[model samples]
Target chain A: MATTDKRDPRVVRTHNDVPAVALRLLLDEGWEAVTPVRVATEAGYSRATIYTHWPERIDLLRDAFAQFSEMPHHEASGDAELDLRGELASFSRAMVEHRLDRALATLAERTQTNPEIAPIRNTFVADGERPMRHTLRALAEDPAAEAALLMLTGMVTHSVLMHGTPPSDEVLDAAVDIVMRGLAQRD
Target chain B: MATTDKRDPRVVRTHNDVPAVALRLLLDEGWEAVTPVRVATEAGYSRATIYTHWPERIDLLRDAFAQFSEMPHHEASGDAELDLRGELASFSRAMVEHRLDRALATLAERTQTNPEIAPIRNTFVADGERPMRHTLRALAEDPAAEAALLMLTGMVTHSVLMHGTPPSDEVLDAAVDIVMRGLAQRD
Candidate 1:
């Protein structure tokens, strides 16, 4: 989240401001409500300026998600597996506490017909992947690491959201233990 | 799926007929469009009859889901582990082939404020669990079997729906293998 931009303060302000409005509208209404024109009108920016910044409809989501997609991260402990577990657990807690799980379900529903959102999902996945991918790679080989990442993140996302509650301690332990063991010795 | 019902044939037809129309509307136009009145109109039943059958708005979804909740099941193999894997994989494929993954994402979204849907989710879970839970119990202890079911199903659900594609064989193997190993020997 470092910023060493030499850009003017006004330019920086608008860059962040427009997407913030777009994201707020997305959360308040739904993804379908977050048009660039609507965001510009709401954010007090010129429609021409908004279009210039976001030439495509999906670009608005891209910008909005780019600003919002920094998932939880933790320091790398000596034990990669333990660090990975802690990060995953932290992400789980964050998703529940922020109610991002609902947002995820909404986006997922949209993904069925709108192929445009695929890249946004990929970005979200990559953002999530960064929080664990390095540590996972530390524990297993190439495909095994990717496989472990899928199981760990997918379990956390589905359980916390679909169950509509925070994960219980025992369930969390079972999920992490399985993936850890799976990573420790892949066939 | 057995019915030894002695109810009058006309009575039985209305019972099955209404929910099938509701489910069709749900899949075609989304859940919010499947109101009892709308369904009654579309299904050629009286509004009063729809009310008697559904009682509440959520009842429409409950009835629709009841008819649709039977997940893919497999004949039991002597090896519970193998049978469980086959069942899980089959369910994964069914969700993709039928595009129930999107339906799941939609239902999951509804579960947020609609506490009434919780039972529907549980019923869906139990229906899914039956296909593998008995064999999972044969392999693991009480909570472990439940935990294994959660991981196995959750991983498959999240990956297939969120990724918006069928799971590759490698990814499916990795997910099932991890949970299988996790269940085989829990510390």
Candidate 2:
């Protein structure tokens, strides 16, 4: 039977709990250890229950990743520069705090061979990029916006990969200032 | 007997041949398929022969990765702006052509728990970063230099991760120009 009933609190809790459990395993032990059986067992759900909900291991992973990939909502203040800086910092913090940079890199490597995971991986990229892209477009046009977006994201991702840690606040602020100054000078 | 003899042409040939063979398998089949047995069979060397050269599977993978991760050399043309631009383009081209981005991304993820691979991964990051860091230092100082390096690298890497390819020559040039201009305006 389908398990999509909103009225049943137990079903809703199980649905929410599965991905959380799977994500913890993924973070602790990498993707190979996140099998459906292991997730169900650790989550205190039955095999059939997890199967009914996710059906595929990739589906479970997609959900788990999506949970962490959520972007911060930015309400622009009167100062576009200040707003952009705040947004960039928030983005960097979220990525570091959730360990998305490492997770995304791991998944990006996998997407090269496993076609099934590419869409999930793309969603992760798209979701993360959307807010930055929006803010950049508001500040600059066409090629400049694209360049800024790449630079901002590149700085964050590169720092994480190189140091195995998210960049410090000072670094993030300095990066945003440099890029913002760069964009302003173009005008 | 030690396999490091200088006079033996055959040993030298086989010694050089194994990493190339393993790299090809890595590129064609992904990292999982690059086992010693498979590599020896493909390269027409015996397993014992390959083992003698590398001694461990991680050793073989390290050599294969090092082969791909070799960064390009960029000489200063006296114009710092032009030099930085050229360096950034060369870096992007090398990363794309060699598939170092994808390969390093894979290795970086493994380095977290695989202590055996951490040193190898560190070398890859350090080698890639040295030129960029050098160029940035020549252009700007301290936090700005660091930020520029991160942004430049991030742009190249983000393009690779999102598109499964390196940034195009046009995009790379435009990106360099934007960041260089940004740096120039800082002074």
Best by lDDT: 2
Per-candidate Cα lDDT values, in order, are 0.73, 0.76
lDDT minimum window of 10 residues, candidate 2 chain A: A69-78
TM of each candidate vs. truth:
0.88, 0.86
lDDT of 2: 0.76
lDDT of 2 by residue, A1-187 (tens): 3456646788788877988888888888888878999998999999999999899888899988877754455666757677767767776776667766667767877776687887887787778778778877887886777878888887777767655666677767777777777777775
**Tens digits of per-residue lDDT for model 1, A1-187:** 3278888788888888988888778777777788977998999999998988889978888887776565446677868767866877787777766556766776777676577787787667677667687887777775566667776677677676666665666766766777776665556
Question: What is the C-alpha lDDT profile of model 1 across B1-187, one tens digit per residue?
Answer: 2278888788789998998888778877887889988999999999999998789978888888776664446778777667866876787777866557766777777776567787887776567667677777777775566667666676677677667665567766766776676665567
Cα displacement (Å) at residue A18, model 1 = 2.2
Query: TM-score of chain A for each candidate?
Result: 0.86, 0.85
